[model samples]
Target chain A: MTIATATMTSKQRMLAALDGRLPDRLPVTTHHLMPYFLDKYMNGITDQAFFDYFDMDAYVWTVPHRHDPSQGEYPDPEQGEIGFLESRRVSTDDWRVYWEKLPGYEYQTVRYRFVTPKGTLSMVIQSNEHTAWVAEYLIKNKRDIDLLGEYMTAPKCDVEAVNRTAEEFGERGLVRGHICCFDVFGQPGCWQDAACLMKVEDLIYATYDDPEWVHELLKILQRRKMIYIQSLQGARFDIHELGGGSASSTVISPKIFEKFVAPYDKELIAAAHHAGQRITYHTCGGMMPLLELIADMGPDAMETFTPPGMGADVNLAEAKRRIGDRVCMIGGFDQFHYLIDCAPEDTRAEVRRCFEEAGANGRYILSPSDHFFDADPELIRAFADEARRCSYR
Target chain B: MTDLEDLRQSIIEGDMKSTTSLVESALADGLEPGTILNDGMIAAMTEVGRRFEEGEYFVPEMLIAARAMQAGLKILKPKLVDSGTKPLGTVAIGTVKGDLHDIGKSLVAMMLEGAGFEIMDLGVDVPPEKFVEAIRGGAQVIAMSALLTTTMPNMRATVEAVKQAGLRDQSVIVIGGAPVTQAYANEIGADAYAPDASAAVRVTRSLIS
Candidate 1:
């Protein structure tokens, strides 16, 4: 461990860690600032204010999508100010949306209907205060997939909008975005995206019942993502997120991952590198089995290394030993247990433990395994203050 | 291979078409319906569970195998009914209210059904009243699932509802999901906690037996 003579900015510290070099101190950050947590715990503070309050490294997320008017693509009429975390909606005339309120449910149910000349497809989504989930899947019938391949609008990167935000958010934190996925419910990985469209269980059954159709659906999704990647050529993003919790070992098998997750993501990562962007494979669950395989994808970083206590099998020290040389590792702290309803000193101890195990190699960022809807504000303060004390000297 | 052995092999391979056809042929040969179910579908699912525990199989494999077993069961159901065969136990399962995530709950329901337990799926965002209603409807076990920590309190509420309705001794309460743990189960006074779908089967069996 080497001590630094001068302090570094939050951006400088994070960039150094991403580059596999030591910074002035260990870089500490949280996975996501959930809106529920902000309202309930932080008195509705802005994400930047929360970061400033904790004195930790911050991150800004933005996804600017461009629509092609020649294809009849237009901005969604119902899109609100905070549209899926700074993402703009673009859809074709054939794509229509409808909403309904159930008699007993707390959330509003939405239907995104895609009408094609061949056929029509629709997906049902339910949204509450925190986030939304798929109520009825998009690809209800086998033929609906054909409708999607034909009529779904392909959204491009709004390079000018992204550049404007990048300029406005200069040096405040890292600029992060994700590779395009299917609208409403999707994953960056091809098979995972298909699993979202078609139910995961049915897609898995189809792997044996109709393997060719499975491959074809994946190819269709992969092509759309490729077009999205092509438009990312001049975007000034520090790190672009790929992968999702669906690709985690806790959800699928290593055999499935090798056959489905790796092939598509590997190519996407290569293309992202060619576009002068960094990639982080975000797996919010068990990753012990696929560590080497994910590293082989050649992403600059891997995240949400959920610890064992949080229903995952991550052994942070062992993970650091195995693949720490290949890519920067993020997340391992058990926020569910230590971040609330525990002693502040205990929270500090867990932070120290994570730093001792994963932070030894200078390329580790201490973060919660994943998002947390509820937390003790004081413990969050302790988490950051303790991390500040974990200086490498 | 014997017809039963072929049936088991087909199911393990997740060959739904072959498994269903084999079940039809075995019935045509006058094999006992109970024997076919025990020696064929159940035996194959046991192997699938073992392979899943050993890491050779995953959710997709388990789902395919479960579908194959369902296909075979579809053929064996009428015969089993004619012979007065009964399921081992009855379990009512649902995702607790305020949590709409159903993949985990669905998997557990399927696994329990595959393990020979009769399942009454109440679907997602099910309230405590639903659990009580299922218990009143002669469910032997109440299995509740919640994927979010925010919704976990509903598990305790369901447990309280059962006790309040004077049905605690008649029904065993089991809870599980991504954020659920044995400690949380204990804290909430649940009878048992299962970490995964396979474990849910074993735990429910133990509670009933």
Candidate 2:
């Protein structure tokens, strides 16, 4: 019997898809909503169309906070640049939310750059809308590390606010959340946090010059994230992304990953799962060397199966055959060459190739291997349109 | 007698303190500055590069080894200059515009410095015009790095701008990064492509030699 035609919220569809259940069709999701799309497409398209255009499940993120409702300039803050957003100044006893609005959408960049006895640190503004995340400082020296460890506060997440937002999104779409990441910086987990808090350059040096100190810093960052994940209990989320792939395999040797990355991330993943969140590990670059290791750590899904041509050397078919049963695969589209200036037919063919390789086990999400900065808008429609055609059901 | 072998071991073990001490001792013991650099320091770094390529060592190992080599060079550079040791060539390096990523470029710069080339790092988010300025400043080879594909085209643009300014032949262009390829280098009319920092040094040495 044919199912009755009815509207499903993006949250409902996405959770169903994550559970390996069929939606009306394939659920196409992006890592982030691009500002370029929002600025150009002003046709009264609601945020839901951000996913609806692709016919994919929509995921809404709401980062909540309770701060003092007052207006004043932050004298000295922790992490990011202050006065650049809509921030109200509060006494030390009160809390505040800092936000900066740009044209379009329900999102704004919220940040408060803090100055401490050690040094300065900043927090990325979390919102329902997509804002560009940028790094304000990279750990450049040992002094910077000491300062970060001493000064940077583990972010205070408003779980009550998040629960309310999730309840609001109930059955409409999926509510997805991640560990509040450092402002326009690296990934949210410990290793990436360390990489961001400390510049990749300085971190490399510290690995040899003072490994013990590095371990301590990573532990602090890891513990902070664990606390955040634990706090995520009972919150509505489909899957939370935790790792950046740059350090996973090709960027650094597996030895470094073993010493610096794997142990901590593996720990975080376990904690997140214990807290009832499905984990999606995002390795944007060459992850072939560490795929088995990453898979063994047991994230529910993995993304951006980069091809060797793109400097991420995963053969999609090989990756699927090897670990397809173990974890859900996301992102196999080639956005670099295929999306920009390629023929529409070529785009269709690429989509078919991804489907054939990753679509076999009913455990893949077809998406661009990573975010595309510039693309022909028609190319995007071809991607979404083709994905719609290749439904598993 | 602090000899080449001892210095080589110092570098190989990444004994920066020893490497520094050995270089001074070698200079005091009347070893020729060029001999110490080529036979001792350079030889050790070349082995480090080989071990890195062979996967016997990783980035941390390579970084420390490079750091140790730098410590040795700090002693050797002034002596070589006083003794009139000419470098292989001059290199100007930078990340392409719109790309702020620089670990790759900085590593390439360090490796080039280790290989005895005078290097001018143009820093990140470098426009094509900055490359032109670097070339006019007497850079013999221009090396461009880009971590993002969106910025990779700037390498080609920089090369074309150099040609337009009539400076292409005077400076060889080399490009390398996570996103760049030898094929990309050829397509963009670059003179060379190095897959990694160690190879970057090798290619730079060959171009100048």
Candidate 3:
């Protein structure tokens, strides 16, 4: 195959790689445009501005969730600026929602309680300027899983809302979203979603202490996700994210992934394909061991090929050799060190390395291994410039 | 199988019910608590660690085996104390200040507990003063974890606080997490750097020894 002489737009570049064809140049992008990074580092520039400043391909993430009116779902009243398609309140008279602000912390702490006719479930999330984390998981006890099954509202795709955003976005970028998980707290994979509800440690322990219970809980979560996937028919998303860090080999073994992660996600991927949307399995850690399994899940793309320097065991050349033909490879550059502390020349070299390895195949998009809270704008400029220079011949 | 072998097998299989019952039965049969713990609980955890290192077991497997061992240990703890037994060592573990991630820290704590070390887990977003306090309170080893690159400098701050508090020699400092490395550990003056939970246990044991 010979390199094209003509240049492609950012959308064309990304869509070309997603379709397993080489664009005029490498499609270079970053994973997330963190609000904190924008506010602190770039003086609150818009995401489009950041992409334009760096001259990189942009990914516009717009998550539009639909709720059943019969289920008494309503939009959250106190949604913030960063809240894109924030979770809706599903509890009616039978299930009440309550909130409280915990006192005394550097960050804001909010505890949300869901009072059900059966029982009550609560989750404590702590948020600083950067992001939020679950201090206390939602599913405190096994019975809470039953409460979620009974009371939780299943989110559907708001096809009109998504189409409007896609129209506004025009040909600027790819419109990305994810399949719905649980409300307020969830992951794309079934086991990973369960882990968020129950803390990861508790869930892992539960897998051994009560394997049957674990399987039952995973199935419950899987059913909820299937409902959401079924609702995705005709949504105008370019690609949907379908996995999380928990399924990565750095977190779980390939054995656990095959047993717990693959089966449910495979079904979800098939559902997504039926809905006329492409899926990308987002594993932000080690992918070396489970590359084939992730490819077998039938996602159009795979991402965050974390390098060993970031405490993950990913080799981009080997990953490209093993599974690049099967799926479009998305991330491999080491932004943790190279994008922040290194020289611009060094950053360019790393970009070239990723291109040489994963870019030879027509199905690769050069991206940071994951989100970077801090990076030199000059280095980012060099990165994009180097990626643009990496043309096929 | 003999009762001890049965107990070990239960723990290895992550059968908490059988492991706890077998421990109680062994104790009722006048078996030595130390022998039961060493031969059954610790031995099973050791095998789990070996399997984890060999990639035969994963995080879920290790976590379940640890849970089974904890259940058996609950039954054997008071007996071991009454029989004048002591833990291998005391280690203080926590995620550093400004970092809220704790999966790695919790894994290290659980693994150290499985290896017979008493762990004082100062949960996420722990400050430098907390490490000094843990050291002053007789924690012989300090294990710090941070998942974010921005929060990684806190490891150096924690090590400096240990030195400034004159507890540097009294406690061995170890660090691990996604962005932490052996070179970073050395740069931060940490005594050791563990790549994962299993390695954390081994490093903690060697440090305390």
Candidate 4:
């Protein structure tokens, strides 16, 4: 194997891998660092410093969005801080958001209402100190999709704001964002967003029972996401993520994925490419069956190659052999076992195993499959230090 | 197809409309409710579980099949009660404290019910006391689920609560979800661990036997 001669920055390494080119070393980073882990383990370190602390390459998450006032869209009056994969909620008079705290049985539950000119759609969300989930989905009735299509405002990309951060973050990390989803509760991809609106079980059943309605729902969601994609023409995102766990093969069958998931997301990936942005389809569950199918959708990368121990099916070497040459591979480390409650020797060996397997080639980033709620700081440090030593030289 | 054959086929294919109609027709034909349940809907669920284990069906297919079983059961439940057909056992199920995920747990509950177990769905974010209460209420099994690693420890806490409540020996504790494993179940002193909804029935049955 030829070693890369030039040493590069984290940003350079990530960009190199994204293009399926060799970097100086295996690019090592992680998916989202959970706040619970950070606060409990690392004394609440800043996200950037958490990467720097381990001396591994960092990934800076940024998605700046603006309002198209000409379309009568302004920032929602009641919305607070924008969060991960979230654009600022753009509200028009016809469509407004109002949330009220509800007494939950054990956690904090809140109901968000979308007051639209046509009608109001409400969803309930519940959360604890660690994370949140949809207690009640927004689309209660079949006709709710029509209300969203007619009244919901699309959030636009704040191109200048995103580029400004990218300029300042030069050589530090890659800028990332995602396509907007359904209002109140949703994920990036069409079927996934639909899953959040309704239930994944219902969505899957809809594919078999009422496929035409499923298609209509997907079309409505894809239309809103298309507006966001069109607005991303000049944003400097290194990669935008699509897909969620609901689309994972672990959750649905290959037949369902091909019929309900692929058709909509493949078009979005193509649109994203046309808008000059790289797309990475993130499936954080059993991916063994869908690797080739996902690669066929034309994403620049695919990620979170979880292993069987984490309740997903991924054989790193097999995955690398299948799609490694086509797209950059990200996240194969079994963090649940190796990142905590294991000897440092075992942790280093895992890092080496990933390097020897998927990382032997140029386009693999060593990362955990997904967010971990708890981990030993020393093991995390060992994880990063060992990865940096996996140099191409 | 004959009424019984159509009843089995509709449920296996997850065709709820056909399943309910065939079940109604079978009842109209004077078939016993228990016969329709055990030989028809429940038999289809057993095949559904087998197909899930063999990878011929996935979560969606299994869930859809479970929905069909439930619909047919809804029609047969009254007749079964009138005839005094007993269930397999009673199971107390919940999603544990601090975790709110419901789908996987609900599937397991449905699958158990399809297998003829009476389910006490304790709902999400259930505390240890609630599980203990369910056990005191004569639940033969305790099934818990947690989607996040943060909430997984609640399984251990719930087990300990059962032990402390002096109901541990009488209850079979089973655990599962995205991050759950056999090792985790063993570590938490749970009676069994099910990797998926299909395995849950097998494990629960093995433990009960």
DockQ of each: 0.63, 0.41, 0.67, 0.73
i-RMS for every candidate (Å) is: 1.3, 3.0, 1.4, 1.2
Candidate 1, which segments miss by more than 4 Å at Cα? A1-6, A69-73, A77-80, A92-105, A117-119
Q: Fraction of true inter-chain Cα contacts (below 8 Å) kept per model?
A: 0.53, 0.40, 0.75, 0.75
Best by lDDT: 4
Full candidate order by TM-score, most accurate first: 4, 1, 3, 2
Name the regions of candidate 4 deviating beyond 4 angstroms: A1-6, A83-85, A103-105, B1-3
What fraction of the native interface does candidate 4 get right in terms of contacts?
0.75
* Candidate 2, A23-111: lDDT as tens digits: 55555666665654445553535566666665555667554422322432232243243322212122232222233444552345455
Query: CA lDDT of each candidate?
Result: 0.84, 0.72, 0.84, 0.88
**Per-residue lDDT of model 1, residues B14-96, tens digit only:** 88899999999999888899999888888888888888888787777788788888888988988999998899888999999
TM-scores of all models? 0.95, 0.83, 0.93, 0.96
Which 10-residue span in candidate 4 chain A carries the lowest summed lDDT? A1-10
Which 10 successive residues of model 3 chain B have the least lDDT summed?
B1-10
Instruction: Please provide, for model 2 over B60-129, each residue's C-alpha lDDT reduced to its tens digit, 9 standing for 90 to 100.
Output: 6677777888888987899999999887788999999767678778878877877778889999778899
- Which candidate, 1 or 3, has the higher lDDT? 1
Shift of residue A306 alpha carbon in model 4, Å: 1.2
DockQ of 4: 0.73
In candidate 2, stretches whose alpha carbon ends up further than 4 angstroms from where it belongs are A1-27, A40-47, A65-113, A116-152, A163-173, A183-186, A391-393, B1-6, B9-13
By TM-score, the better pick of 2 and 3 is 3
